[model samples]
Target chain A: MNKQTYFKKFKNIKYPISRRGLLISFMFYSFFHFSRKLYANGEIGGPFRDRFQSFRQTFRVEPNPEEAKRIINNIIKGRDKRNNLILLNAPDIAENGNVVPINFSVNCSMNGNDYPKVVHILVLDNPFPEIAKFFFSNQSGSADLAIRIRMRQSSEVVAIAEMADGTVGEDRFFVDVTIGACS
Target chain B: MARKNYRRRLKAPLTAKKGEVITIKTMAEHTMEPGVRRDPKTGLIYPRFIIDSVIVRYNGKQIFRSRWYSGVSENPYMSFKIKVEESGLLEIEWIDDYKQSTFKRSVINVLDNNGNEIFPIRLSEPSQSENLQ
Candidate 1:
């Protein structure tokens, strides 16, 4: 049947007001309300919740082992193997936190077949831990990169590299900051 | 609006041979504000301050460009390598999000394999040596 005719047929139909109908209608309304409540609560646990949690954890000035593991697992999920990745962390005593130099090198063949696809660097302790993402092609020649990053406090830096073979490699470095970046 | 007290220094060798990769390092002084902090006295959030882009030109030809972010620390420092093909003017310009800008220029002279000057150029302003000549 056409959609218009289907709707028109039901538009005027009225069922008798019986106990069974009332109970079924009540159950349907209750289910709808319950689902709405569940959805509203789930909104608090959305993807951005991890970002908010990271911000809060930085301010609390406390070490969170669970949060650290979550970050590691996320990195592992995005890594690709067949590329040699090296992650270098800044020295523990950073004279200046504002412009800490971080260097990364990948021992990849750099050939069209085994080139590195992407390099992602993250500072797990920073307000925004996703520091930088670099896309490299064969034109890059070498997979060595150097960049400066800001850190609020001493934290661990993680580097993940994805290779052409669909394998993942990772390295981590711990940095100590004598001077905070915020200052 | 407050007067910013920052400076940048870019250094590279004045001469290189053709097809030689030269390392250039630049250090700039500026506060890279992340805009996430509130002033204790005024309770006002500071606007983000960062060097947004840098471009290097060789004789009016674009050679290198970089995009920066707040993740880069204050008083930013960057180092990169570029190949010198011939004698030309090397110009570097830095621009910040606040619309403040600065430019630094250097003359690059390419030498031959035998260390003989193939292209001679001077970048500094007329000095005592030039005055004597």
Candidate 2:
């Protein structure tokens, strides 16, 4: 039971190496490795690769142009009643994009069908376009609001007012942001 | 876990004439994380934590409401207008993304043309007056 005898107990045991099994295992490993490389390089997985990843990882999500358009259209719908109902006031030049002061007022009298049901604020270049929405009731004497918001870049800020009588009014304002804010 | 204390500020007129429009301003102290900014040291994205909605109620009746997203700036400030007919309590509630809510309350005094303050509930009645007599 000495250490030297215990270490030499199985020193003479021998095993045969099979070249066929080694070749097969190597082939499987290489197949998987190469396939993964191909996938990582976008040589395979065409549809999925284009939409998701191509190895360049970015923390900030890119703003989708089509999605912004879709949201604008969804708010305006087909009935674009271009009128002087909604008056949006935003600074033409924002020194700090982190806090952009914006205010909007609806000319409606807040009576029966003239009052605004909802006023939606959208920034076209932000990753998430829809910013805020205001719901007003008859008790809300005036449909006016002032708020502070964040902007990723210089873009058109849109305010769409949907009235109770099935009418919609849209207003757009362009803001020049000196320094973009990350959202 | 919501460990930060959100400070709320509400400003409204103490008194108003009947059918007069009054302006109300509200502010809430919050970080308003947009869920996209990464930590510079660890490179980990900060989760979105923002005030989701704001509700303004007059005498327990909602008069104005708002829904907000991550685009709102930190320490959000909002101001709106409401018409008052009778004196009532005004409550403004700010609801956060984690379902945490904070509110502020203020009482408004509505007055009539004769400058008599309109009480929410009638104080004097014919039976009461007769009993007093």
Candidate 3:
């Protein structure tokens, strides 16, 4: 039957709603109303945007481990697999941790059909752990990047590349800092 | 704004083979006070003045961007790669905590193996450079 005829025929029939059904929906709405629909990283709506906010202001005083946990959790975002698409380069034994190089690249054809939508680098132990977050459009040409970051102590660094298909690749490397950098 | 007259040096090649990945290194000499340190002279907290963001764009398309914290070393050095596409102008913008911005631009030449322009020349190499002269 056509959708129009089906709707017209159904409109003539009235079914009484049960009180239990109404109560369940009201409870469901109230439960979610207390919680904001957001990811761990505060991605409120839409694809990831290259929005910049004050990182220091997010947590005051000493480098709070709890705050870093929230930030790194947002970076990982429950993605699966430590794939080979991302290459993370770091010195196994950094003579000076003050300027350790945290470099990485995503393997993908920078075509409109598929590309890394965002690339994030996180240092697990820095006072401000998030080192870099890069948003890549098709015009980015390539996915490779290199930069210097400071590490306060021996810690694991993670690089995750989020592709347009909603899947992500992760890579982790460790740096042995001889002397602390973030004091 | 960062210290007045702070200089930015971009050490990179003006030309690259098309599709070849090349490393572009940049460094800016400026003091990045994190605001936690108390000035010896005043015995008070020094206001933070830091270059918080660095963005690199080529042919008007942004390629790489990063947020730098105060923990980043002084004279911040950033090195990264770009897959050489069509040649155009490469611009670097440095933004600080004080809303001050510094801009440096370079003419990128994406040439084929042969000495030919792979893309239309947008800007020439720096005229005063000893290499070009």
Candidate closest to the true structure, highest TM-score: 2
lDDT by residue (A77-104, candidate 2, tens digit) is: 6895858989999999999999999999
**Superposed Cα deviation of residue B107, candidate 2 (Å):** 0.6
Report the error of model 1 at residue B49, Å. Answer: 1.6
In lDDT terms, which candidate is top?
2
Q: In model 2, which runs have C-alpha deviations exceeding 4 angstroms?
A: A1-59, B1-5, B123-133
- How well does candidate 1 match the true structure in TM-score terms? 0.59
- State each model's CA lDDT, in order: 0.67, 0.84, 0.71
Sort by DockQ, best first: what order?
2, 3, 1
DockQ of 1: 0.12
lDDT of 2 at A81: 85
RMSD of each: 13.4, 12.3, 13.5
lDDT of 3: 0.71
Question: Candidate 1 at A56: error in angstroms?
Answer: 19
**Per-residue lDDT over A1-183 for candidate 1, one digit per residue giving the tens place of the 0 to 100 score:** 899998999768887886798999999999877865554443433322344422212122333545655655655664544344555646667877877888877776666667657666777776555555555555344666677888878878888786767777888888888787762
Worst 10 residues of 2 chain A by lDDT: A47-56
Q: A1-183 in candidate 3: lDDT tens per residue?
A: 798998999778867876798899899998665433443246563222212235333222445556666665665577775558888888999888767876787878877757888787777666566666677776666777766677778888888788888887888898899986643
